[model samples]
Target: MSDIQDRHDSGGSGAGCGCLAVALLLAVVAVLLGRPFLTDDGDGGAQAAPEESVVATPTSERPRSKKPSGRRPGVVNIFTEQGLRGVRAAGTGIVVDPSGLVLTNNHVIQGATEIEGTDTDDRRTYPAQVLGYQKSGDIALIRLSGASGLKTAKFAEKWEVRLGDVVTAVGNAGGKGGTPSVVTGKVTALDRQITATDQSDGSSERLTGLIETNAPIKPGDSGGPLLNTSGQVIGMNTAASAGFDLEKKGASRGFAIPSAKALEIVRQIQRGEASDTVHIGRTALLGVQVRQPTTPSGGRAGGAYIADLIPGTPAEQAGLRARTTIVALDDEPVDSPGSLTDMLLRHHPGDTVRITWTNAAGERRTTPVTLGDGPPQ
Candidate 1:
């Protein structure tokens, strides 16, 4: 008994918090899937929002609905595999429309060369294609054919969330790996800020203005929904580091990037721009860490300035000097931190760009930088 007790004592508790990840949270409420509960700034955001408009191929172009239902099945699954012969890594997705617009966590479908979904009716899993994905925000959308009777998940306005409210989180928790599961919890925070970790390498992704709940989440829950009492989804539960304990789970924990931001990404995919969309692997995927710069004109109140650039990142490769004041990316001018982060993540690595900036010496410079592929380690 003493020896067993000694080992238990030595085992101890770990509070490393995954040694600090810059990643954002992904909630995967397995089994059936539930929904929960569910911001930002300038130039980057400005460019990102306007250019995005989700376009779903009209169902009229596809075969007729076999079993017409009042509510379309709103959720589907994204499948991935270690190799062609490896065990498939599949996660849940929410159907956004009858035309088969689907929303899921970026991580859930990260390496998937293809994705597919099935409804309650034993409909065969149909082929899925990435419509568009924004890793910084932990969101992605896919397109499917031959899907009908799809139930669209209802969304709550961002302002509708309140603290202490009960919520249900649903997704495929254990995976083909296991069956889907659902967990219940309450809103511990509204507009919480927390960093998520990359499942691939355990790097950190800073996600801000997110929802928090004292709920248990696991690997298969990556792309699930956080549903309110009314069964309306206010936020897409993206992630939480597995290392956190019961105590740390609440205070300053878990994150759900809001639906408003998701609306932008979903719209962009619907517009036929989905095929070439980039998945930069979340966090400040921009490769540039920045702060809001004070301006002479008080322009935009919180204009953004590049603070640090990752080596070999698009920003660094672009010849963008650290601490430079970025006035624009492509044709859109950046005025806020969130905007800049979103804008940079919107473009994939190796993509070309026209960047205009003001150097510390007050010299106006235009440098062309090609976006790099993959995230900074």
Candidate 2:
């Protein structure tokens, strides 16, 4: 598992400042559709560069481990290659059905041009097709092509999870393949909210009602299962805390979406529900591309500067144009493009919002615009 950066209700600006494409637009769509990842521009930091994929080859054909009764045989390793950048991301998944329907974090598979997975039984990789995703829930479901008769992870029937209860996290730590990493810890808290960022693009997401634990949720651990002492999955490991300052004590914290919540969202996604918070397509549109401001020293310029507005879109209809600087959404301060994207996460399609911006005339203006939905990216 790689280091994950996080903050409590207060969010960070995220590190490794640079211009990635507007991939966050999809996140905004997720928000508008009803579930928001509360992302923001925290204090500026150096953005981490994209990591190259490392596929390890076996030297010897080691015998597979004997299956332990009650252990989850359906836990899978999810691997994805996103965009032309080929920014690879890996995480854990749980097989939900014998037909190879798998569930994991949306952030784990978002923007993936190609997705694949390795089942625990055979450890053989298979091509995966995304069924659909719910951004607000931060969960996604995929179907392994030609996969069947796979074992599935079992979920706890009730909210048997309690503070101080022992738990185990299983996932691909450090994005490394092979057997999954199992880390043990106790539940520290529950129903907590935190903001998580994509190291690949500096995009942030606000997650709520998460199960907090001291378990080492690392990179590639996202979408893995948080198992109880009985080996039944109680939660889905999602975000890990990193970049803690002196004020904070100990190592980074890890958070997971409650299995009940995650499972509910997955079922909704599987049903292809088209409700306010659940949508079947790509993302909602504001029809505007934003760029970050640059400091005189050639560093990052905070806040999103409108670069282009898709003509005939809601933004144009609301009188927004290129060269406008978005400073706030619904009165929330906007310090980076991610901030605006984060704010958009709180809204849904067909919803009207008060967007504040600075025009080329140096005047601040506010407008209420209705959001529109678009096809998947």
- Best candidate, TM-score-wise? 2
lDDT for each residue of candidate 1 in 1-377, tens digit (9 for 90 to 100): 00001111112222222221223211110000111111111112211111111112123433322221221235554455322112245566777787777888765655343455654334447777665675556678776777766667787543255566576676654443222456777766655545543332223455655666666654445566777665667667666433433245234334455666677678875674533234323212234545556657754444356666656555676577777777777878766554554465555544577777887787878888765543212
lDDT of each: 0.50, 0.62
lDDT of 2 by residue, 167-276 (tens): 78887665666677788878776566666554423555566666667776666677888887767788888754233221226744677787777777778877777554
Residue 360's lDDT in candidate 2 = 64
Number of the top-ranking candidate, with lDDT as the measure: 2
lDDT of 2: 0.62
